[model samples]
Target: MLKVQEIRELIKLVDQSSISEFVYEIDDAKIKLKKNTTVTTVEAKPAVQQVVVEEVAKPKAVEVQAVKQETKVEAVKEEVKKDETIDTSDLHKVTSPMVGTFYQAPSPDSDPYVQVGSKVSNETIVCIVEAMKLFNEIEAEVNGEIVEILVKDGQLVEYGQPLFLVKPE
Candidate 1:
């Protein structure tokens, strides 16, 4: 059975490469990845375990479901709405560097590192992304004020997914 970290690594490799499809089988576990014009799907079946990640180009109401035993995980990458009244042209986007769980604070009892209206510099640690038990500190990378947070405190974030919007200083 492949570990979660291994699965994530595979996803990254597939997304970066030109291959449209990939498959791997080891013992009772079988994994398949497929990429298309509008969506990418990853399916893993390991005995009673299964994991699936799906991303669609269109912006519709997102629905996620996870099951026990024969599990299925669905992650939908929502498109940022461009027709909103707010002018985002001058805003800088903070994106996730890898696929992981986004944590706004260091711990459950701690306050978030930054919030909307918080001033930050390039070195500011805005959040932590936990991938395979490793907590990676994510920097603001730009001097600015946090305008909005694009994800929830414990939400799963995808690679290159926008995590926040910053109004540059």
Candidate 2:
């Protein structure tokens, strides 16, 4: 069993590193850490007679949850793909600069910065990408009308992922 301080140190190290998941096991004790969307989960299983029963049940529950999440993601991807069927050869793409949560509005109660058919210029703030608690203003780099939004509000965006398609002026 790890001391409280040791577990805290491990969490700090993992959070600072690029790895997304870590697991450690010794004898009958196990520790698992997972990082997702800035949320961290730490699971510590100790040596006990019921440990086997718990370990068996936990994986099934996790598997079901993972499947459900995957299904939702797939549906969203399909919707995005349908939007992409439009001709985009001459359109300008506004892409995310970093891995972050894409926010269409400054606040939850506010209207979005831009929407389909909205005109934008090089300096126009089209959206926000939040990374590591920092809200980064994303601008449209071209003079154009927004033809489509490629991501949903509060979605996780990868670095360089296209956020919007714009029809150039």
Candidate 3:
């Protein structure tokens, strides 16, 4: 497992430079770091000071609890939303434009790009994918009604991954 310090350092390096992302596998350790544009100033705040000095030392209990809680909340939310999952009986699948982390919303606290049963046109934004610090807005390829969302928010999607399965008008 990669230490928190190592992960932070990898994030720092990507933020400090023009490199969008980096990935390496050494032995059993695999490190894949993607630059978060929102985390820009946070990474640049402490180059002079050693990472140890400014880092807040948190108890393992608190860290583990937070992570567990977050995951649980996410799982519950997905479960509830699954109640609304469409039959996929007759829907067209809109695939991903690029390989990146797929975001349904512009930000975590905002509304999603599209929702179940949301009517959309050809030019409508289906989703926003953040790749290499770039937020690329994906368009609805077909004019239709959103019958199903194939992927969940915050899901890492591959190229050509189906995002929305639509029912044409």
TM-scores, all models, native as reference? 0.52, 0.55, 0.49
What are the clash counts of all predictions, listed in order?
A: 0, 0, 0
Ranking by lDDT: 2, 1, 3
Q: TM-score of model 3 relative to the true fold?
A: 0.49
Q: Candidate 3 — worst ten consecutive residues by lDDT sum?
A: 38-47
Candidate 1 wrongly placed segments (more than 4 Å): 1-85
Query: lDDT value for candidate 1?
Result: 0.86
Which sections of candidate 2 miss by over 4 Å?
A: 1-84
Question: CA lDDT, every prediction?
Answer: 0.86, 0.92, 0.82
Candidate order by decreasing TM-score: 2, 1, 3
> Could you tell me the lDDT of residue 103 within candidate 2?
99
Candidate maximizing TM-score? 2
lDDT: worst 10-residue window of model 2: 49-58
Structure candidate 2, residue pairs in collision: none
Candidate 1 residues 1-169, lDDT tens each? 7898999899889889999989888887778888665655555563575779798676444332223312322211122344444677999999999999999999999999999999999999999999999999999999999999999999999999999999999
Q: Which is the better candidate, 1 or 3, if ranked by lDDT?
A: 1
